[model samples]
Target: GNQSGIPYSRGFECFDERFLGKPLVYCGTLGTIPVEVGGRPSERKEIEVGDWVVMCGGRIGKDGIHGATFSSEELRTESPAQAVQIGDPLTQRKLYEFILEARDTGLFRCITDNGAGGISCSFGEMGKYSGGCECELEGAPVKYEGLQPWEVLVSEAQERMTLAVQPEQRAAFEALAKQRDVEVAFMGTFNDSGYFTVKQEGMVVASLDMNFLYEDGCPTLDMPAVWKAPTVEAPVVPETADFSEVILALLSDLNLCSREYKSRMYDGEVKGLSVVKPFVGSQADVPSDATVLRVDYKSDRGAVLAEGINPWYSDIDTYAMTTSVIDEAVRRVIAVGGDLDRIAILDNFCWPDPVESEKTPDGAFKMAQLVRSCKALYDLTTLYKTPAVSGKDSCKNDSTRGGKKISIPPTLLISAVGQMVDVNQAVTMPFKAVDDMIYVIGETKAELGASSYYRWLAEQQGAAEAIGGQVPEVNGEQALSIYRAMNGATRQELLQSATTPTKGGLALALALATVGSGKGAEVDLSAISEGAVTALFSESNSRFLVSVKPDDAAVFESLFAGLPLILIGRVNAGEVLTIHGLATLDRETMRNRFKATLQGV
Candidate 1:
């Protein structure tokens, strides 16, 4: 171990295979610092009419030049090695410590990360609210010298922070930085000049009116959007006679399979703060709905992380797909101890370059998809009162090789974070005990337009283009009611385990719970609805499978009074999963089939 005080964490995603030839190797740095604040809303440097702009940490370098512009385009095979710079956490740690020390002294007015567009963006953002900024590029520090004026101004060097200091406190702040062995430079000044001016050697190199540059300089395009909704008949098939054959086929699909092999590469227990780690259960290898990270072990309060994405659904109805993904993410978090009131989200969009060029033939259509998806994100989040705190958009996903074009499907990743009231109240997706009653928490619908079932069926029949069904829709009001009931019931300890049917719908959810618990189930489809096919297979929105002990059934029913909930089944000790008038499948064989796709990977 390097003992660098920085933990390297990894994440695995099964969907990335749709784009890359190999598994995606992702890594991140995690750090936690105490947020020292009193009741009076934590404050930062209030940029006055006149303040000095200072840069902290490493010197500027040619490395990572045009980093922001590069990200807006597709990754080129011959990309410059200097365009992606590695981070130095140890250097960052020194700056982090010094900032805290200076922050306590109240020498700095406000501070921001020198990420992406380097100082051009950081200073511009911080000074926008004030008047504007004037930067002296000649004073900026550079690595090994010999940097052009613009290079010194826009270099996206790693591990840097920009701070605004009062004119009176500039000397004191620099002195403090020297004492802490933190490098600091005063290279710019904020003023009410209304222009972001950049000068080199006392000669103005660039000067743009702040309001125009930040606003009116960029013109909006009146884009055209053509919405062509696909039609589909959901393969009007009869109930299967032998359920095991159908169940086995569904389990073996790549999407429905287990992610244990890839997920195991991550050290979920490294900090010992995982109440419910990524994988849970008797074998400690089953997927948990949302991971609950214990924020403070001394205190019961913790945080939950959950994510949902349905790129497949985006093909037909991008707007509905966006809302459905958000709903799925929220529901998964609620399945754990997460409450709706504290839920926040991060929306990461991955789409083809929408700017029309010779290479991007249908760029306008792709751009329209991005716009619609964003509108849906705004609408759904506002409806639920859950705000999206941060987001990123990757537009350059299209690439060409040997004159052959390859592009990724329109994709959005909705990641949610919520407060867990108590770590002790955290729950998993396995049935806690035999004979516990299983309940369905929302209505099932015939929404299979972009479902994994339809995908497999289309592939099987060799008529994927001919398939179309209704995509899932979100009713924010109905979802909120269900979430409240489940979250409250979970905290009260009346529920054994809870899970929402995702990718594979109710059948897959039931199968996963059984496999994880090493238990069996007996479900009566008639209990929920008369239409067994839709009841069994439709991947509807805002539904959950909650396990309640027989003794607490009355209380559980009362907890969901007036909500759409029904007693559908019971957890059993037997090894066979039985769905009345549907399928009866063996658990072990099915579990192996589920893991087949990821075998030896």
Candidate 2:
């Protein structure tokens, strides 16, 4: 049984059997020296000790080694079973030499050794990777003993292979292997027909269709969602004594905690260059923020970010949910110091089947919203030189439980990719040092239609008027200017300029700060837009929490030019949070809230 969720289970085991221990010994000899090993002259010569021998074909004995002798007397008295008569090791050596020669000559696109299961497993996998091809087994070279058709099929022969060679180079390849003292055999030609055929002496022994053998039979799953609007009450002024406490409450939420535990298992250094690893100290993973990848002097670094949202709780909230996906993906890249102008988008649509007529038309409605949102993003990306690179769809996310079919919540995943001119200037989620200034760049609104806060705090079920309020459109020209200005900034410079768009607006910013520094952040939001304060604090899309140097303020302002660049607050020196104008909360309280919620407080 599998302990982990992984589909496959594998391990090693050992056991003890009660018996008297004894040394097992055996011997073997050669009937004739292989043609590649000096032929008949080598066979007539006396066998010498330390000569390595191998079974070239068939299973004639249990040990496979025919016989070996330390003296002439031992050789004369050894029985056929005791005296192991095996093939020449020189023949196997020739095969190895031939492969190297072929590689040098560029005769094969790919090749692999054939050991157990004869031609089946080795050739089967190779054929699949090669887009399917036929291999003939009759042309195989065998030792002196006549092999039965079935024996040849399952023969555990040493020094053999099911090589893939082009028609033009087959003759030269054979001559090269022969010169190296290896046997070169042509099994079959590659074909696109997608079939595997085995033959012995020009007679068919086994055949199988590639389609049936290669295709996985597992069925696609329809994971349903049973969504009920959360029943928590919204934060009233009386619910919390100070606004700073509320900010701390939001920061300590389960959704905002770092996921380093899961991320550490990944091998981010496999490719030798990981600009931004998944987990960095205290920073949380932000869906759809640009993940910058840089490691060299030249601009080869890339960025990736993703986001998913569910909006079944609101009547008219589906569109907002869709837009949120796009917004989050883009913002993620930006948070990690991505070039917004060179970004690309990938959309993943996971929803209930639209064909199912018996259920409420939530599936169709969500699908429509997704299409519209994608079209909107398409236009934006095209204007900004960002394109849609790839996408995936998972429909029919409905499951049956207790003899009842249920549909899952509306979910959408949006991914964005971008290029970074210099990874050295990349900004990451975590803060590098303390005392860096924090700022919220985008304008926030009061929209809270299908927000997690509404579901978790207010405990509301039905949609509210504020669900899809006014969405802040991206100022492309302004975004372009800011991106250009920050292109040459260093990690330290970025930390000094960090800021938060509190509520969910600065969620990405807060995550970046947390990652940059394990310690909690202290930022003032007094300079942000008061009209959209709630939205800024909440998780609205298209917002950013930027860190800028006080001295670079003029340069930053010049970069924004005509864009909406709000100087909200600066990073404090201690482990306490201060929001609005007067509210303050210590880090201990914030940490408790965050940790407790993860365990379902």
Give me the candidate number with maximum TM-score.
1
lDDT of 2 by residue, 1-601 (tens): 0121111101111111100011112111111112432223322322121111111222222222222221111112223342333444454555555655665665554555554445565566566654455544555555546656544555445455655666566667656755665545556655555666666667767777777678853466453333332343333313333455445556554455433344444444443445655544343433213334443335465444433333332234444555555555565566666666666776666554544255644544545544555565565566556666766554555544445555544455555666666665666554444555555555455655444444334432342222333333445555455445444343234334333232245533463455345555665554554533453345544555666656766665665566556665555556655555545556555545544444432
User: Which candidate number has the best lDDT?
Assistant: 1
TM-scores of the candidates are: 0.88, 0.57
Model 2 misplacement above 4 A: 1-242, 269-272, 281-291, 294-319, 359-367, 430-436, 460-503, 507-523, 531-536, 595-601
In candidate 1, clashing pairs total: 3
Candidate 1's displacement at residue 538, Å, is 1.9
Give the C-alpha miss distance for residue 64 in model 2, angstroms: 37
Could you give candidate 1's per-residue lDDT for residues 155-261 as a string of tens digits? 89987899888888888998998998889889888988888888888999988888887878889977655455545555435455355676688887777777788
Error of 1 at 54 (Å): 2.3
- Give the RMSD in angstroms, all C-alphas superposed, for model 2: 17.8
